[model samples]
Target chain A: MSLNVVSLVSVGRHPQSGRARRADQDGRAVELGLKLVAKALSVVHVGDPDDPVLRQYAGMGLPSMTILKQDKSIDAVPILSQFLQQEKIDIVLTGVRAESGESSGMVPYLLAHALGWPVVARVADIVSVKDGEAQVLLALPRGQRRAVSVKLPFIASVDHAAEIARQSAFALGLRASIESVESVGEVDRIRVDWQESVAKSRPKRLKTVKAKTAAERFKAATAKPEGGTGKVMKNETPKEKARAIFDLLLEEKVIR
Target chain B: MSNVSSLGISSLGIVRRDPRKEWIARNRLHPLYHEVINEGLGSVVGPSGLIRKNPHQIGFIGPNGIKRIDRLKGNGADTSNKRHGSAQEVVLPLHVVTTPDFYLVVVPDLVGGRLSSHDKDILGLAHALQGGMEGNGAVVAVCFGDVKETQFDLAGVDRLIHLTGTEFEGFTPEARVAALVQIDTQLAPQHWLFPDSIHGGTDLGSRLAASLGERPATQAWQVIPEKVVCRGAGGSLDIARQTPRIVMVLEECGNAIDETRHEVLPISVDALEIQSAHLIDHGQVAVDPNEIPLAEAEFIVSAGNGIHNWAQYHQTAQALGATEGASRVAVDDGFMPRFRQVGASGTWVTARVYLAVGISGAIQHMQGIGQCEKIIAINTDAGCDMVKRSHLSVIDDSDVILSELMQLAQEYGVNDKPSQENSPEESQNVA
Candidate 1:
C-alpha cells in the first residue's frame, strides 16, 4: 500500500514586516509531500481557512487544503495528532516553525510527542521512501547538508534550505477551495497570563570596570577613541618584523 | 574576484587604520554600537578599549533617578576611615552548603565529547544566581558519565554531582533525557540551568520542559534571583516562573569571572540508572578536530569569501600552527566544513587572537569572536566591517600578506603549533 502522507500548512509572516503572508516553508513542505505521494498528498491546517493569508499558500501547486477549524482557545497539537491517527498517516511533513504568533517552533515537537513519533528537524530534501523507511538530507548551519534516515510514521520539518517554492498563480489562487472540518479536542487549560506589551530593544550592557577615582573612570569611558594603528613595513628587517608580530601575539596571550 | 588589484597606484599596498574613526568617517555605524546609542543606553568603554554591555535593571526603580550607577559622576564625601564609635555588629549564623537550590547541569557535547564555553557561562550564571540569593542558595554541578570534576572550575558550586556510569556515554537522545529527568526527580532543584552551546541542548531542554510540563525559555542571557532574562521574540523577555522548578537554556554569556579564585572542593557523586531506548542504526558525520579549535586553541586563522585560493589559506594556517576558521560565506561555498564556520549560528570562539583573511566582517561573525583579545584583519577593502573590528588592518592582498607572514614565521622559528597540552581528552571545561 502507498504511504498515507500529510503536510501541515500555516500562514507565515513576512520576514521584515511581520505581516501575515503565505508561508514559503509550508509550501516547500507541500512540494516535498507532492513529490513523494503525487496528487494523493493531503494538506492540513488547524486555523481558519478564511484567513486570506493562506490563499498565497493555496496557489503554490496544491489544488486544495483542509482546515481543521479550531477555536483560538483550543490547542492544535492534540487535534492534529488525533486527526493524523484517524487517517492513519504513515508520514507527516511541516515547516520548522510558523513565522508569527506563538512562534516557539514547538508545534512539530509537541505533535510528535502527542503522536509518539520521532521528529526530524531542518530537513533540506527527501531522497526516497521504500519499505516503511525514508531517506532525507538534513540541513546544517553554514550551508552544509547531512543525510539521515528515519523509520516510518515520523514527522519532518522543512528547512529554508529546501527548494524555493513555486510562485503562487493568481488564477489558481482564485479557483482553489479550502475544506473546513470541525475540531474536536480538549482545550489547553494552562493559563499563560500574558502581559502583552510593545517590546523594547534590549538596553546596552556597559562592562563594569573597577575605577577607584574619577580620572581612571573617565579615561576608561573614552576608550577606543583611536582606531587601529597599523604599520606598513617597506625596508624593515625580517627579524624585526617577525619580532614585532611575535610581541603582539604574546601581548594578546595567543602564545605563552 | 580580482578586485584587489583595482586599487589606485597612489596608495601603498598597506596603510594605518583606526576602526572607530573609520566607522565615523564612513558614516557607517557598527550594528551593535548603533543599537546601543539608538536605545538611549549610554555607551561604556572597558579598560581593554572594547565597549562593555549594560544589563537591564530588573523590575525596580531605585530611589535615585539614575537607572545606572556607572552614569553617576561624583566624588563621595569620605567619612574618616577610623571608626568613631565602638563597632556595633549584628551577629548572624554562618552560612553552610546544604541542599542545592540552583542546579547547573553541563550537558556534554554528545558528538565532540567535550565541554563548551557556554557551559562555563552557565556555571558562572548559576554562581551569580546563588550569590544573589545572599548565600542562602547552594549550587550543584551535574554531569553525566565518568566526567572528571577537575575538567571544570567549580568555584561557586557547593557540591558536584557526577552521574558515574558507562550508559551515559554515546549520542542517544533517549539516554540523555532519561538521565536528566531522573536527576531532576532525585534533586528537585528550585531552578535548573542548561547551556545552549551545542545542537543537542535545545532538544534536551525542550524534552525536559515537556516532561516537566513547563515552558522553558531558550537563549537565556541573564539571571536574577527569581527571573531569567531570555532572548525573547524580537527583543529581551524577562520570565518569572511562579513554580519553584524552572529550566532555562543559556546563550553565550562569556567567561566573565575568573575561574581559578576558589580552591577545588570534594564533589559528591551520585550514580544514576536510566532506561535505554531502542537504538536505530544510522550514519554519523564528524567535524575535523584541527579545523575549528574554538575552545582549545589560542590562535586562529580564519578565511572569508574574498579568499582566492582556499588551499593557500590552509597552508598558511599549518605553517603558523594555528587552527583554521571560516566565515559563513567560505563554509557555504564548501571551501570549509560547517564546524569550521565562526559566527552567531556557528561556534562562538574564545581564542586569544584571531586573524581574519579576505573576509568582510559581518555582525553574525563578529558575535562569535567577541572574546578574542585581539583581531587582525587583512582585506582588500580598507573600510570593510571586519577591518573596523580588528586592532590592526592590512589594506592589501590577503594572499600576499599571508604568504609574507608565513615566511616571517618560518624565518623567526615561531613554531606556534597547536598546543598539545590542551587535547580532546582533557576537554577543558573552564573557558
Candidate 2:
C-alpha cells in the first residue's frame, strides 16, 4: 500500500514589474526536482495535472502521477496535511527553498510538524532504507560532506546536489493525464502583522573585463587571468610607497 | 554546569530525513547533542524505538587558541558603547576544543584547504578533553553567547578551553550533530536553548534528541518556570508514550532573546582571547504607515500558465493596471523570479480584482496567487479549471480578447500609462 501523496508547488509574484518573458526556467528546475522525488517516493501525486512537469514525463510512459484541484483560495499547508493523514503517507519531500512567497523558509519545517513527520533539511543524498531508518548525506560547507542517520516517515528538503534529476523529452511530455478533485476549505489572508514586500530587483554584480576587442569575445571568455609583472617598491619609504600600493590594491579589489 | 541534577528527558532532533541507511537506531533514533562524541559513550536504544551501537563516535571537543583582541583598540570598546558610536560591542568566540576526529569548524579557509587558527583551537580542545584518550568525542557547551561584532571574551567561566579550528566554520548537519553528540553524552543540561536562527532548528533539534536521551521538541512556547514546553509533532511512533521533561523553542513564533553572556576562565592555559570579528554595517528605512497597505488593497490580480504569450496580455494589464504573475509559469520564464510565482512559493495575496489570465490554476501555482475578492479568468477552453474556478469566465480565445483590449486601450487613450489608476503614491514598494 502506498500513500497518494501530492507534491504541492507554489510561486511568488515579482514585487514590481509583473512580467515574465523567459521560458524553461520553471520547467527545468521543477522537472529536475520531480525526478529526484520520484526516486524516493512510491506513489507521487501532483496538484495540477496539466502542469508542464506532468507532460515532461508523459512520453516515457513514466509512473502514474495524480493531481488535486480546488479553489485557489485553499491554504496548501492545511490541505496537504489533511490529505497526508487521510492518505496515510509515509513521508513528504520538498525543496529546501521555493522560488516564491513567505520566503520565510518555513514550509518544510511547518509541514513536517503539521504532518507529524521528521524533516531532513538540504539533504544531498538518501543512501539507503529498509526498516524505518536511513543514512543520508547533508552537504557541508564547500565540497566537504557528513553522514547522518535518521528514522523514516519523515520530511526531507532536497538540495540540487541530491542527484542530477532526469529530464522528460518531447515524446514523454505528451501523454500525461489531468485528474479532477473536489472542492475543499480555502485559506484566506490573515491580515495580522502584514509583511511589507520590498520591490524585487536583481543585483548588478557582473563586470565586463575584456582585453580591449569586441571580435575576441570567445577568446576573451576562454582567457585565463593574465599574471601581472611589476617591480616591488622595496627601496621607497614606508608612507610614500604605502600610498602607491594602496592605490593599486583598490584598482584590483586586493584591498578595500 | 550550572544545574545538571534537575535534568529532565527532552527529545531534540532535527527532522531526520535520510531516505536511505536502515539501522534500528535510525528508526526514529534520536542522536545525543553534547556528550556522545566527546568521550565515546557508545550508543543506546531509547523508548522512542531507536537502538544503535554504531561506532561512529564523537570524541572530545572544545575551543582552543587565544586570539588577543588587539588589546589596544579593544580596551576602548570594552568600556562603553560611546566612543565607538556606531560599532557594536565586541564579544569573543568561546568554543570548547577538539581534534580531527573531533571535527573542526572552518569557513572559506577550510574550503580553500587552509585551516584557520580556530581550526587548531578545535584540535586543542579535543586533545585536552581526550587527554591522550582514543576514539571521537565533542566538547560540551552549557551555554554560549552571541559574539556579534566583538572579541571572544574568556571572562566569567570555570576554565578556558579551546577546540578552535578552520573546520569549525559552519558545519553540515552531520558534522554539527557529530560534534554535539559528545557534548550531549557528557553534560546533559536541564535548561537547553539554541540559536534562534534558520540553521539551528532544522537539524540541531533532531541531533539533540539522539544525544541527550530525551524526545526534543521544536518551537518552545512558555517555559512554565522549571519545566520547558515545546510545540511540535513527534513523528514515527504509532503508540503514544510520554518521555517527558525537556524544553525547546518553537519556530517563528517568538523573538529570541539576545543571549550575549557566558563566563570563561583560563585554567592553566592563559586567557581565552578573541580575535576581531568581521565588520558589519547595518541601516534601516522607515515605511510610512498611512499607505495603500496590502491588507487594505481592494483589487488584486494574479497571472499563471494560462497566459501563454505575455504580449497578448499587455493591454489587459495596462487596462486594469493590475499586478501580474503566474501559477509557476511566468515566474520560471524569467518574466519574474520564482519568488513572484503565485503558488506555494510566493506570497499569499488576496484583494478585490483577482484576475487569472491564461492561468491553468494548478494547485501549487494557485495556492499563492488564487486568493482574491473576485477572480476573473479568460481562457479559450471552457473546460479548463481556470474557467470553472474564476468568478467570471471569458470563454473567448485569449489572443483575440487580449488583442481586442489592447486596440480598445489605444482608442481610449489610457494605454501607455499605468500611473492613471487609483493613487500615484501607491506605486512605491513596501518602503
lDDT for each candidate structure:
0.63, 0.41
Which has the greatest TM-score?
Answer: 1
Tell me each candidate's i-RMS in Å. 7.8, 26.6
Tens-digit lDDT track for model 1 on B29-51?
Answer: 44544442233333479999997
Q: Once model 2 is optimally superposed onto the true structure by TM-score, how far is the C-alpha of residue B250 displaced, in angstroms? A: 20
Give the TM-scores of the predictions, in the order they appear. 0.60, 0.33
Show model 2 residue runs off by greater than 4 Å.
A1-8, A11-63, A191-256, B1-431
Tens-digit lDDT track of model 1 for A113-154: 778787777788888888878887776543435667778888
Backbone collision tally, model 2: 163
Report the alpha-carbon TM-score of model 1 versus the true structure.
0.60
Index of the highest-DockQ prediction: 1
| Candidate 1: residue B160 lDDT (0-100) | 59
Q: What docking grade applies to model 2? A: incorrect
Q: Which lDDT value does model 2 have at B155? A: 20
